[model samples]
Target: MQTVANFTPNSIVGEIEKVLDTYPYNPYQQAFSIPDIRQQLIEYVLVRIPCADSSCSVESSQENTNQVPVSKIPRTPLQHQLHLQNLIHQGICVIMQMKSELISQILCETVQPVCEPSHWFG
Candidate 1:
């Protein structure tokens, strides 16, 4: 049984990287290829995880701040790993969903109207 101290942010990131590596690069349209997008996905998962330090807070301007207090629960290493895995999967799903919607919107905007059969024949 690993202690809470053992579950550092680096370990969490390593797990995320491992999962990301398992996914193929083609289907995402090179989304994972973009460093910023990949980092965003990692950050998404990291923000959701409870920080080990009670005083830990993200640095953001007052106008844009949306802070939420997270309650930490003690768990075994396996449970911690599982929780992170679940969060990683969810983050991937959200990214993919957004990508799909963006593609759909672009297609809708770019698609030309079809000509009638008579016009084609004429």
Candidate 2:
């Protein structure tokens, strides 16, 4: 087995070992081929996206700024909360509407042939 110090992050085996460390299960439980292990690990790990502010740098920015930068748009706590609530409400409404329409379509198809009066149901 290659030593950790000798391992480079570029190789799939090394990446798999790093990912395995994040989980509680024994890393050696199953024999893993480099490509499959790499693919699975990459799929599971979340990718970070940069914030919307064009001037913001992920590496240099502080966790929270005392004042918003000139390029960034600032919002009051209440405004931010309300914006989030509205977005969530709209998303839920869209999802529920789609689900209801799909269910209605399936019910219509299943009942169409069995109904004695298709024209009345339609």
Candidate 3:
């Protein structure tokens, strides 16, 4: 896997902007790619976006000499909980952004000059 040592905030914002720019502006019907865009954004946050800390090992298991002597896991339930919350937050943020983008596209489409559909009927 290629590491993202040089990832910057501007690049992140650029990616979001790129998606927004390409988004379908049709307000009467939803964009066919909106669902795909959502999935892509979610995947980008969960997988493609690199972590700032390369030292942290998500798969590292700690040995504990405690009560039941069960197999050790990489992370605690609390960590997982926090991680899930973070993902949810990120997802919501992206969705909200898309909402604004969709609105912008709708407005832009509405403001543009309209043409008759005479070619379609003929």
Candidate 4:
């Protein structure tokens, strides 16, 4: 039985990195090149996903309690992989949205106010 503890966040990171590798030449790839940014996205996704067992839910797990046996429905390896891939896609969407908002805020802050032209008669 694969316990929730066995599913490390690094596994999710590895899977995400594999998908990112396919877009090596993408213009936005540089954002993920920073390890911290990539890690943040992984953390975001992990926090949103429920643990396989309620006892080890993301909320309680953060408290750093010792691992305890949890009863839950078992999923085949293929099913688990597909579920993870779906999550990776969702995480990528979130990163893109955050990047867009950041860029918009920077542009708003740096934009200069345009002066109105004086009338020729004036």
Candidate 5:
């Protein structure tokens, strides 16, 4: 979700390469089969929602790692909005990183057809 204003094309392309490089280089392993990154975003939302809800009996001292029910806590409108914004920001970061990496790979692959043959000709 990074805006065009925030990211130059070159930097976005670099990010794309970095993400692709994270995977093993096996031809059989499709890079598009990227593991479920959404789960991390879900976990972030889960943690923030419960923490924001003021009605939860669990003291703030309790660690966020515990799984708590949303129904167990009453969340104020403002609290919910704040947590929602936080979650949105986190989701955007994850998505933008993924997108940048995919675009980089596509650009590199596409350009290969044009740049590679000329080397042999010369």
Candidate 6:
């Protein structure tokens, strides 16, 4: 997630627009569906949890992921599922917020209301 402190409002809004524009304009042909995004989020979140010793590497994490059910290994199936769901929800919420902010900016800057007839005829 990006913080507002990282960039000026104008730059951030432009960047977001550029990213959104890269996607397929047709909803039916979209590259990433909600389930696909959710699965990606789960994988990302799983690999990101810090190890007990605080020196976990990608290789080590993969090893842990593949390990058998040993007594020392962390094992909580339901908890893990709930955590993944939470992460997915958070990811979607952040994207929605960015889009909302971009829409608000566009409406504020580009959209105008007609207030008088004098300008309309010209």
Model number with the top lDDT = 1
What's the distance in Å from true for residue 120, model 5?
30
TM-score: the better of candidates 2 and 4: 4
Q: How many angstroms is residue 114 displaced in model 2 relative to the true structure, after the best TM-score fit?
A: 20
**TM, every model:** 0.56, 0.26, 0.32, 0.55, 0.31, 0.29
Ranking by TM-score: 1, 4, 3, 5, 6, 2
- Which residue pairs show backbone clashes in model 3? none
lDDT of 2 by residue, 9-78 (tens): 2332343455445444322213122354334333332111113222232222444565333233223445
| lDDT scores of the candidates, listed in order | 0.63, 0.35, 0.44, 0.59, 0.44, 0.39
Give the lDDT of residue 36 in candidate 1. 62
In TM-score terms, candidate 3 sits at 0.32
Please report the TM-score between candidate 4 and the true structure: 0.55
lDDT of 5 at 30: 43
**Predictions: Cα RMSD each:** 9.8, 17.9, 11.2, 9.5, 13.9, 13.9
List where candidate 2 sits over 4 angstroms from the true fold: 1-74, 101-122
Give lDDT tens digits, candidate 4, residues 1-122.
33343346767778778767766434345656656667877877677555622324222233445433233312455766777677777777778687766645544555656678868778
Q: lDDT per residue, candidate 6, 1-122, as tens digits?
A: 11111222333233333443554643311322335443443344444333322322233233466532233333354543344445444544554454455445544554466666786577
Model 5 lowest lDDT segment of ten: 1-10
Worst 10 residues of 3 by lDDT: 65-74
Candidate 2 worst ten-residue window by lDDT: 1-10
Residue-level lDDT of model 1, residues 10-97, one tens digit each, is 7767887788778775545356555766787777777777663333443333343454322343355677678878888898888778
Instruction: Indicate the residue-level lDDT of 98 in model 3.
Output: 62
Model 2 / residue 2 / CA error / Å: 49
